[model samples]
Target: MVGEKRFRPDGRKAFREKEEFPMTETPLAARDRRATAAATARALGAALLVLLLTVAAAAAVSALTGCAAEEPTDDGDAAGVATSDADGAIVVASALCSEPYEQATSTNQIGFTVELLRLIGEKSGRGIQFTKAVNHKDAEQNITAGLPEDVAAKVAAGDAGLGASSITTADALEGVVFSDPYLHADFSVLTKMDTGYDDLASIQGDGIVVAVQGDPAIAAWVAENLPAAEVVTFDAGVDALMELSSERAQAAIVDEPRYLRYVQVKEPHLQAVETIASDKDYAFVVAAGNDELLATVNEALAALRADGSYDELCESWFGAAPERGTATRSAGEAVQDSTGA
Candidate 1:
């Protein structure tokens, strides 16, 4: 048919005339018209390819010469370039060399902080990634101290958003922000079951060695409360408690819930003497000024509890359901210094 548009066998639209032609038009004339159309299409395709190649080469030269581009960080990521997911997923960094709370370095990432990060992502409808460090304090530090420059840049870019670990809500840092506390806990003094070093008073004597986690806050707490005791700090809470097993330390100071589980399940030889009076709240943490991330994580935490997922998780980890999250209470209940949140 004359002037009938058509498509190629490959599904690309072929350049065809839609104009009407006289019935007297001959086959030779039609063939000439088709040949001309084919020639024109080929010319257009060749020009488009050249244009694309020119643009690509310009971009490559500009990148290599550092034209208006930020330098790569020590970690090899561009300082200003975002390493976050294309789908806007956030990363949660942690380094808690501890138990129940951290249990880091495991393939399963079994622990309170890691599981909480997972649930928060699920509830918030956001993708989440976990970045493990050598220890948790460094994880929190990354949110605050501006180390591993790429992460700080990522936070600003909204790619890296959280500092997950057994991060207490207390001790607000300049660059770190806290979500509502998902769990409330008290400090505790744990001792060997047969050591007769059960209470704080028993371990407060001069030369009484108390094993404590390297968390500056807990270490500071031990220093303030037990002046006469020789404080030995371990990199991890589990390691500190292990010192108690060898009589290297008479007592171990740690979060009440973690030690409770440790005593009942992992190490029956340990006893939680008693919980300290002042309570602390464990909360999800984000970089300071990350208002959007903070709000999302808080909402997810509340929903996780309201839907009973928090309870089930607690049962799995602690062997019992836990009390209501301190978020339902006053934020005032948290210690305002290195003590609590």
Candidate 2:
């Protein structure tokens, strides 16, 4: 058959007048056009993907370099820089050489607790000073002399600013308020490795000579728990450790962190076993009357927690951030300082 002629809908001839074009079942020109269109579509898709990846990478970069919402602010003074306040200055009385909490060299003051107090001062524009309390008695004396009111008197009189360097007890909570817990230390019992005492229960009937300093809480706990062992009280935990090293005491019950520090120095052949008791929560004591300062300190502590400073302090000292909890009543216990300054 002759080549079929095509016409437009407007009745104009569609085929060229030069010659009738031959037609095949599938035209190579149409196939080529389709292939070109597909290629163009793929190129466009790849270009769009590249654009998306580039935007995502830029966002990741911003997140890594403190542009994210939770990024830490780097401008705040973190080291132990003194802060000044409206008052002449807030004098912070701290025991100067306690390890894991406060420590100092000939030229530097460093530790988790000291740094925390410094941060608090920076936040409040308050000046803080570290003092050397030779012993618990010295600490108590200094606290007694510095404040116009005594803790017990303040409890009786319902005033604030009467806290001493002591542990908080349920009874004390009745009359005084404790600052945020600055430190939490576990108590452990140390014995000569050769003593064969595997745990606290094993030493119950063994006439274990436990040496401790003036910490009455530890003494009380021992008295109530290890009724069979004879607990010998000393002037300081370090003194007790010295006695144990010299073979004066068969075992020593002391703060776990402090015991770790002591063994490093004395090199005593001792083993430590810890009893999971309530953590020793150390806080600043305030007289019942000075609610203002107590609130201020508590607010400062809250700020420290929000800013990651508190967790940083915890990590520096305890190797982990402390779990936060609600406020509860803890007071009215005997005061003793095992830290020998």
Overall lDDT per candidate, in order of appearance? 0.63, 0.55
Error of 1 at 114 (Å): 1.0
Model 2 C-alpha RMSD vs. true structure (Å) is 19.0
- lDDT string, candidate 1, 261-328, tens digits: 66656676776654454447777656666566678888888898899999888777765554422111
Worst 10 residues of 2 by lDDT: 326-335
Task: Kindly report which residue stretches of model 2 are placed more than 4 angstroms away from their true locations once superposed.
Answer: 1-88, 94-112, 130-164, 167-176, 245-247, 260-270, 287-289, 318-341
Model 2 Cα shift for residue 250 (angstroms): 2.5
lDDT of 2 by residue, 156-180 (tens): 2322122334334432445455677
Predicted structure 1: clash tally = 6
Clashes of each: 6, 18
